[model samples]
Target chain A: MNGGTNRSRFSDLVDDRVDEGVFRVDRAIYTDKAVFEAEIERIFEGGWVFLCHESQVAKPGDYWATEIGRQPVFVMRQTDGSLGCFINACSHRGAVVTPLKQGNANVITCRFHGWVYDRGGRCVSIKNEEAGYAATERSGGRFDLRRIGALDSYKGFVFGSLSSDVPALRDHLAAAARWIDLLADQAQNGLEVVPGCSTYVVHGNWKLQAENSVDGYHVTTLHSVFAATTAQREARDATAGMGRTESGRIKGKVPSGTYDLGNGHMGLWAQHITPHVRPIYEARAWLEEKLKPAEVEWILNRGRNLYLFPNAMLMDNPSTQIRLVKPVSAALTEVTVYCIAPKGESKTARAARLRKFEDFYLTAGMATSDDAAALEAVQDGSLGPPSQWNDMTRGLSDLVAGPDRDARDLGFEPASSCPDWDHEGMFHGFYRAWLERLEKGSGVA
Target chain B: MSTNGIDPALEREVTALINREAMLLDRRRWEEWLDLYAEDAVYWVPAWATEEETTTDPETQLNLIYLKNRGRLEDRVFRIESRQSWASLPLDRTVHVIGNVLVESAEGDAVEATANCIVHVYGKKGAATRGSRYDFAFRRIDGALRIARKKVIFIDDRLEGPVDIYHL
Candidate 1:
């Protein structure tokens, strides 16, 4: 049958022949509609998807709209100041309840039928109640905006899952939280999203961006302009040698490496070359008093490009950005980048933070445009003629098992580590975790 | 009728300079584009705080594009000229259409002008169009007007993909 030929198994797609020093992914995964559908259903919706930061909904009645896979969802701060998440669909007629992307809402009135819901998402009133639902269904949870199956937060980062079958948020996060701590603990009151976000689309598979975040191999080629521009600026500003990966491979003499922090979360770590560019460095004295010696050093100098799998990547270098990837289709990905900073930082530090943010983080910025161009070029090239397997074997020689002295310093227990930053072997954990989920979702395991 | 008390000769000068900037951008005249701005120019594009609100301050707030001086703009041109700028490597083509120009006022040697703009760009990822409003601050230097400050407010801030200086 044609069905059997067309529907290839997930394992066949990701050929992981690690014993032979080979791991490759079929290019069809980037273009096939079926694979995209399965990913949205299994990976994005079925598991924990990051909602917004707790700071986004800090005040009571504050509402933030987002999506879980393709399903529209909204999160709000209840009157009692706790967080609540619900499907954006109105209970009455399925129209979007909160149309505003972000705002404060004392009551959510469905424009479709005038069904009124309070800040907590409970149906308080309805237009002509007697004309519609009976006494049993007029009020209570049944007629309110539907809540997600599960919602939880870890250190101010909120996550929601449409299926209750998922593990607890902390368990799911694991040692990835240690990396998150470097970002979270930087703040006095906690980190804030800084009020605006840069949203744009990429004409490539989401996985391309997912891979690029933790990849150091492409640095010398894809963004030489960044290095050149920074070099000129560094000469002007006399930026010190803290540790800039953009300057290319530092080799030995530095604590630079990569970690597969379990469950597909991966990162590339380095002590910064120009640490002065980072706002956190300006707050070093205050942070040292609040945190341990290791944390102070790790948080300020040895920064990282941390991916929380599936959706978010907390980039602590180039700029502190929370980059969220939403797959619009197999070929298109919507990206939203927000500058996150420790609350109530100095104006000088804040200004420097934003200038750095503008330098590389946005679509309009210098480096990202080149990245977008390169990523799109890769996508275009991958689509031509015959399908082939992509290699992920660059760093196989450098791959190490379990936590290292560097990882142990931060209480991080990654599945694997590579001392060299440019190696490609760290991506194995990401692919393995991805394949496992898809296999389980398709019942192929 | 559209001069708004501005000298008709000065109005023509402003129009010519604006068109010159657009032509240089589309032609990939990177150095020429840099020359059009004053040495201490400010270029800013603010980000939307919400659907209806945009953050007002660049110093203590967020911005889509913010460059305080000509050095940053020079860096932008330098990147594009580096030929390794993949986003701008092939040198994307942009057709900048400007209309409804109004000279708001003349404050001594400086002039405030506003215009409606649409920049159609064709790049590696295909075509992207941006509609925006440009608020410019110009000063007459050596008997010619140079852009001292330029603020571009996008009609739709939810850009679909990567954008750059030439795009708007």
Candidate 2:
């Protein structure tokens, strides 16, 4: 929480334009309180924060506890078939209303004070109806649960904003909507969360983790442990002579690029996970034989995700990609990872898919190791005597325009290219939106 | 899955053994902790369910971690000592309360036992929280029960976070 002259240093560190394709970021963005404050005010508050996907709350009364900015909120499906986001705290004494990870309930009753609220945020009953504030209006002013300023959904993905001035959810999503639609539309049988949450807390600035998810550059070296492992090395070696086809897992090209999608929306397209790396193809083959041909294709090629600014990110790998970056401080962040599956899939298929994701990408996977190294390493650099600056200018001066200016082409390389410079645009777009919100003010959402 | 005939003297000895093991882990008695396991003991915390099949390779089961013998586990210990294991910087202090001990079967030297345990794990800065629930089995070696197979299924295993490098 270091403030004062350090604030300006942080502002300077984060506030810079991309001129020749290089990105210059100041060191204080990670350490200074002022910059973090402004970021919470502007970026985290001013943009659409991904709450959870429709799959999570498909059934009435289903709820998921998530955070938007610094606020701990839970989104629930009302009995009337609508979605709402409200602070998780009880109105009486501010204790967490429903402490469980998730479950189905028509109402949330505070265990501390016995105050009860229905899914619609109406104060249904007080512990002692007669003794506590005689004849008090339960559904009025200070009694009813406070909901987020704006609650909306794009396709089945739910998002909330605390800021009054933020644009409509779709407008805020902008070009990123296309990707969301592509991912959401994959499940013709309809998607549902796979009964678990991948919650992990890291010891680093939240932004560092967000950038790492889409950066694609750190994959090679940071994940050298995996690359060196016998199993992973064999996976890579197995695909050595596969004709270098881009259409399968790596996508159309190696130099698949990234771009600014306006309103803090950005995409790092084509940086796909290798199917061969995990037994995804083998599992899909097993599933295809047992499932309809169309169902098999949809399950296999669920495109990757970029994020809709602030704290949410779309992973685009079969399940939901909503990532909420809750900053614990200048030094710590907890990321709640959620995955979704087609609601109508057989029990066998669901089990197989969940197993695949859990094995390779959950808390204990090679992916978590990459994240652990990147975040901890960044924490080391930021906490130590501040360096002049860190360079994010990997793929500068090579911005070749594709069908869309934001969608440029990366050159020939492994689909899992470490630090794909072209993907830096997504990282840049996020920071730009973040800078705008910080210059503004903060409010509770 | 059944607790048939329970032995009083044997139960007292087994409870003592479990308590002693818990103390060793909490006290970071690495060598004594290693000695508690049989030579061919297995320590497995599967990433997910083992596929239902008669023949499936344990090597390719996609386990969170599956240590075959004491040597491999010692290698993990060796890495912790030699390398910078950040998660263990302050070293997590643990309290494993093992209770509900039941002997399922007795076959020669091996005795199958099932127990309900609650392990509270405390990080360096805070009070402990529930760690996991274990379903353990023991085998007799030299007239004393040693850990034959340990399966610790964490309630929060599916969640992402630092894993326990040391045994729980």
After aligning candidate 1 to the native by TM-score, how far in Å is the CA of A402 from where it should be?
1.1
lDDT (Cα, tens digit) per residue for candidate 1, span B75-108? 8788877777777667777899989887888867
lDDT of 2 by residue, A1-445 (tens): 2335446433466645566445777666777676776677666665678877787677899987876676678898988899988888888888878757567898999899889998987888898878757676674657778787889998888888766667788777876776665555555556555543445677678878777766656544444333333233334335342111113222223434455556666665443345442223435555666654544443353345576676777765433445667877777777766555555655544544544454335445434544665576677676644464677656655443323422322111111222243345455566766766665556444
| TM per candidate | 0.94, 0.73
**Model 2 whole-model lDDT (C-alpha atoms):** 0.60
Top candidate on lDDT is 1
lDDT of 2 by residue, B1-168 (tens): 224565666667667777777788777777888788888788766543311211123343334545556554554454344334444445566777877766666667776666656666665335545555455678888987898887765545323345653535
Query: For all the models shown, what interface RMSD does each have?
Result: 1.4, 7.8
Which parts of model 1 have CA positions greater than 4 angstroms off?
A1-5, A234-254, A442-445, B1-3
Per-residue lDDT tens digits for candidate 1, residues A1-445, read: 1122255487887879878988888777787778888889889988887888998888999998999998899999988878999999988778898969888889989888788999878899989887766877764578878788889998999999888788889888877999888888888777888877778888999998989888876766776668778778767656553322234332223457888888888888876665665677778788889999888888877768998878999998866889999999989998988989888888877787887788777888877777777788778777743746788887787788998788888788999888877787778898898888887783211
The per-residue C-alpha lDDT of model 2 at residue A140 equals 62
Query: Cα miss at A194, model 2 (Å)?
Result: 1.2
Q: Note the residue pairs that clash in candidate 2.
A: A13-A26, A38-A438, A42-A437, A216-A419, A217-A418, A217-A419, A255-A410, A255-A411, A315-A321
Tell me which residue pairs clash in candidate 1. Answer: A201-B160, A242-A272, A242-A273, A243-A272, A243-A273, A244-A273, A370-B87
Poorest 10 consecutive residues by lDDT, candidate 2 chain A = A408-417
Model 2 misplacement above 4 A: A1-11, A15-17, A20-22, A127-142, A230-256, A269-305, A317-322, A344-352, A401-423, A443-445, B1-104, B107-110, B114-132, B138-149, B155-161, B164-168
Name the top TM-score candidate.
1
